[model samples]
Target: MRTIAKLENVSKTYKLADDQQLEVLSQINLDVQEGEFIALLGQSGCGKSTILRIMSGLIKPTSGTAYQYDEKLQGINETISIVFQSFALYPWLTVYENVRIGLIKRQLSSSQEEQEITEAIRLIGLGGHENAYPKELSGGMRQRVGFARALVAKPEILAMDEPFSALDVLTAQNLRAEVIDLWKNKEGTFKSAFMVTHNISEAVSMASKIMILSSHPGRIVHVIENKMPYPRNEKSPAFLALVDEIHGLITTLNLPDTPKEHPISKAIFENAESKAFENIPYVQISRILGFLEVLKDDNGRTKIFELAAKMKEEFGSVISIAKAVEILNFIETPGQDVVLTELGRKFIEAESTNQKLIFRKQLVLMKLFRLIIDKLTTLKTLAEDDLKVEINNRFPYENADKMVDTIVDWGRYGEIFEFNADLKVFTQFEDSV
Candidate 1:
């Protein structure tokens, strides 16, 4: 029970071009103990991966320090290895060469390198594919090569940033089981592993400790230990209970109306007082409408967590979609549950043309869309560059393009206006108001 990696009062901030600091992680004080599997679970953009990079000495925190085995980490060293979501393999190299590369600068004898590579591949269940190129292997096999490459180094700690995320469900499940088995029996070279994942069941099943991170300037809000024994049965009441409990915990946790003091991110986005260009990411309009239909089929009321589980989507993705629904005033999210508003029900019941009409009304009501409409009326043809510049003036420079693009998509899709992509201009269509 020795402390291996520690983050003491770590706060990381990225300076943006707008002279604004994007706070990544704040006051993160945590540690990894010997023989512990720690899962950092949170929404995307929560800076979970940033924590991994900081611990691995891949990046330095703006404030606080990262320690490896009681020593302040100077830089990336051989003591730790990371398996990334992407295979991170040289496509031209064979599996043997890829695994062998990790031991390149170690000054090991040729015999030593061969032995380590062979054993690492074998342990990761990639025994016979050593000579095959990465292009010849399946995604799962390539990831096993990634595992083998990280393992051949004999690191004290293993860090993975959504390593299994890109694989199929069954494949990810099998890999998780294998890794958990290795940890259960102390087969792998590492004393502990840190995994950044959003999979609730995966975190509950594998991690001896789970850290729940909050979005918008991420922070570790809770750290819980798993008391259940190994070989956790997903069908069992205990496993289900843990899943439900965590889901409830997350959905109930203070998901503030205002995300981190930003009025623009608030559920009630700026009113007439301010016209801050909103940065809400656009999920496909079809997906948004379909999501509402699913909710409607569920009687127009379902908890966000329940909807996420049913849709097999991440909480963050669903929440962002719900935010869009909120922006259009199509759904009433009084709390964790969403209720389809009368406008939403009407839109669903309407015919195609009527639906487009409703969508047009909703789009025109948006602050950005209204501003665009105003510009089009004044200029006759609003250049996309001018629209982006207007957005940048109101919001962060980073989100300007995304914000403007989303606005343009809604404009064209809703039939509120026409967009000439080649000319990068917004023009009034025959149906435009």
Candidate 2:
């Protein structure tokens, strides 16, 4: 890999009021290849965006160094552009002028800069609308202008801090596809893209490499390779499997001390403070997924306290046991010994046999919805055997039956993702069918 950027044992510390140095990032090291789409993923305050700033030379590491433009550590280079979460476009300037500003500052000819600005506007699908000011455009359109302005600079690498975080899902998905297309078409000249994102699926689907940073003192914990090809089939077994694997890796890192009342990690088994699934931080998600992993055995049945001891042994905390029970809905009474209930057994079996498959299938279904379709069809004729085969083909599991049961339940809960099931298996709305 051609080293486009690198952070060498980097550390950043800040002096507080009492002159106490607080470390934000420690022993951080990451190297990105030329034209590699890399995502830095972690919880808030994990220094994900900080690393981007460091790489962009917006901030200096207190210790160690970063290298860009193929040399020793240096200050920020001119060949970089950043698109902030907030579209940092100029309020006074029209979209054209806003984009033309960078070229003008570079001392390009008036005609040349205007031509470049025109090209950029067209590329971002905002051609004639260049006369519109920021305030005149909708949020999505304003973002499009920002993207055009960034591209007009013609930098080697682009740094985006949650660029689409504010957009609605439909618009964000379209913009994401457009950005990916932009990168692909301009690969060598553009070099690569580096970004910070809270969305795991966005990271997984887009980046060639995803680096996960740990919290407290932020630092790189794991780096994942997205081996699946571009225009990735999010619904395919391969893509989902990779997503689950990454989820597992993240879960292991944030698995906390075991609980006193339960057999699961507090991070995994949530009562009220669990952040309502989607709002759950990445750190918490990782631990929750890991705890779920321990609830199952080779067969899809619950393993009682055997898995409990194994989990505790690995995590070195009693909270693991408590969380395990909570997640399994396994009751632990003072008079009752540790045993798996019917619900607990089913949960374990479902998790053990079907969690990854379900996750992958759902993601794929989402992808299918994004692609244009002519006619919708119904899956009512998908017999039990056909459903079984579809599950096996798209999301294989050790326990196909258990996986099916879970998938049906997910469908019932509106979590099964009805609108976009799979390109291979599309079903029309009930009335249309």
Candidate 3:
């Protein structure tokens, strides 16, 4: 099989203020073959999009190499085009114009350009909406425009960044079906496609191969091939087994900073003051509490999507909340079904005062939370700027901001510390209970 694109030991790092560095992509490698559709799967912030960007030549890797057609890819390779997750279409442009944008620089005549644009729109099922502007179109229609634009370029490869993530379920499904049909039929210049997504079922449904990535400083842990035939039965035993296999890969994936999982690392885990730079997630405590209550009432088990529907929340948002809750050990998930833990159930069943106690205990157990308490205890009080400076030494600037917020918000809930907003200082809370 001919290789269409390749990344050889690629790595990426972002330099933060004061000479600190945040490594996003490690010595990872990937390839897009002549006719294979690959799905790069991992948690958010795992550098999935960074890999896509490197393949598309939108950004250069800090080390190693990204190549297309055996040539080094520097900035914007001509053989690849991207379909963004946000449906990035120009508001000032009509459907015709939006689809026509990619083909504008081609050497084709005006008539040829118009013909190609019209046919591209028709192929993506956006026929007769040529004159419609993006603002006038539905979400599905807008994304069709995005697909149309990428197709009109007549590129050999399409790089999609969670293209269907922002759409409704039916719409995403419909669009995925349409694209698969095109790939199956060899309808366009699209010889291959690769995309980044967090959804396992979507990966199994779409790609011929799936690359699983490890968290924080992304590295490819395994590449599983989907050998099942196209139009494969999602309900088939084989398909279910594949899903379960990949799901296991994720659930048991080791986090880089989780030193407690190893015997020799026990010393590090015991020293609360040593782990001062725990990577804190951006989830709100309220969502964690809310999900716990819902799970408890629902017999402590429910499908992820079912929970989302019951709570009238978006699927992706609920997943983020679930991840946060999972990290704190309040929930255990065998697959997509989240089961509340014994602690989770206790939190829900306890009286108001007892609930506070439970919440506080859980917060203190968190490495990030405990770190903040440790700092405040030692310093008596520290201004937010000083705390942020302390954080900047460990994390990238943007992530440092989030870690700061997580400590402040969760710390306040635990009453582990008191914050004076005007002074921007955090002080230890008075003893109680």
Candidate 4:
């Protein structure tokens, strides 16, 4: 197979205010080969979409080289087209017009362009929708137009960023099947496809190769090859086993104390104050409590995947909640199973007031919260804007406003501090004061 796109030791960093740099991708290396369907799977904000951008030559890496067809990629690669997660269709334009934009740079004559667009629309099952505006289409149909637009250019690589994520489950399933069928039947049209997804099952169902990334300066930690025959049986032992294995790998990688061998774990544990810089999962306290209650109902032990299914939540949301709980030392995710810690059991068993006390104690133990508490102690109160600025200075890569909001919510819930939303200030709790 020919290598179509490659990233060689690429690392991407964005400069934030006050000379702070936020590293997103670290020493990443990967390739997209002809006839390959590759899935990049990781938690949200792990720079998966950034990788696609690099491959399509939409953006340049801060360091390292991006190549297409063995040549250094400069501007946008003409042979690579992307289907965005949001459908990215113009509301004012009809489906045909939207797809025609893909060929905007190509020097095709009017007749040639029409023939290509028509063929792409037919192939993607959007034949009659060409004249309809985006508002007239269902979510699935909109995504089909996204596919048609991407396929219209006859690109060698079709890159999709969570293509089916916005659709209903049934629609997503049908679209997945159709895409796989198209890939299998229309061999020479597109040599390879690369997808960014959070859904393990989706990756397992489609990709021939799956690359798993670690969050916070995303790095490729594990890669698995799926040799399972097409039309994979989700319930089959082999399929379930692969899913379980990938779940274990992802869970282990996300945990704080899994092992120091990986860069993620090293970056997490190398400093005592590292937690201060870590981006706290922006999950609400109620969700964390709710997840714990669900786990308790399952005898305080269950696989993370099972918990996600039980909650009827996406894997990423469940993992975010788990990470929040884990940061408080209330849970321990060992392999694929999330076991409620002793502290967690106490929190669950405690009354509302006692639960608040426990949560407060945990908050006091974290460096980030402790920093806030110390500042509030000395300063009597902290302005929300000031806190946001401090958080930005500390974790420049994260959304400061969102972090401040989450901090206030968690703090208020734990009685660690009181926030005056009207005044836009955070003050120490009266008892602490």
Error of 2 at 398 (Å): 42
User: Which digits, one per residue and each the tens of the lDDT, describe model 1 over residues 358-417?
Assistant: 999988777778877877777788887777666655554235555667777677779877
Given candidate 4, what's the lDDT at residue 263?
41
lDDT of 4 at 359: 93
- In the range 196-289, model 4's lDDT, one tens digit per residue, is 9999999999999999988767899899999999988989999988998888887777764553344444554556565435468888988988
Candidate 3, residues 61-179: lDDT per residue as tens digits?
99999988788886777888899999999999999988888896577998999889988888999988999999999899999999999999998888889999889999998999899
- lDDT per model, in order? 0.82, 0.62, 0.80, 0.86
lDDT of 2 by residue, 89-200 (tens): 8998898888776574467777888778888888888877878889998788888887877787888887789899888889998999888889988931467898898666
Q: Could you estimate the TM-score for every candidate? A: 0.85, 0.60, 0.86, 0.90
User: What's the TM for model 1?
Assistant: 0.85
> How many clashes in each structure?
0, 25, 0, 0
Runs of candidate 4 with Cα error greater than 4 angstroms are 256-279, 349-351, 382-402, 420-425
Query: Judged by TM-score, which candidate is best?
Result: 4
Q: Which residue runs does candidate 3 get wrong by more than 4 Å?
A: 254-279, 301-339, 365-371, 385-398, 420-423, 430-433
Clashing pairs in 3: none
Worst 10 contiguous positions by lDDT, candidate 4 = 256-265
Summing lDDT over every window of 10 consecutive residues in candidate 3, give the lowest-scoring window: 255-264
- Which model, 2 or 3, shows the larger TM-score? 3
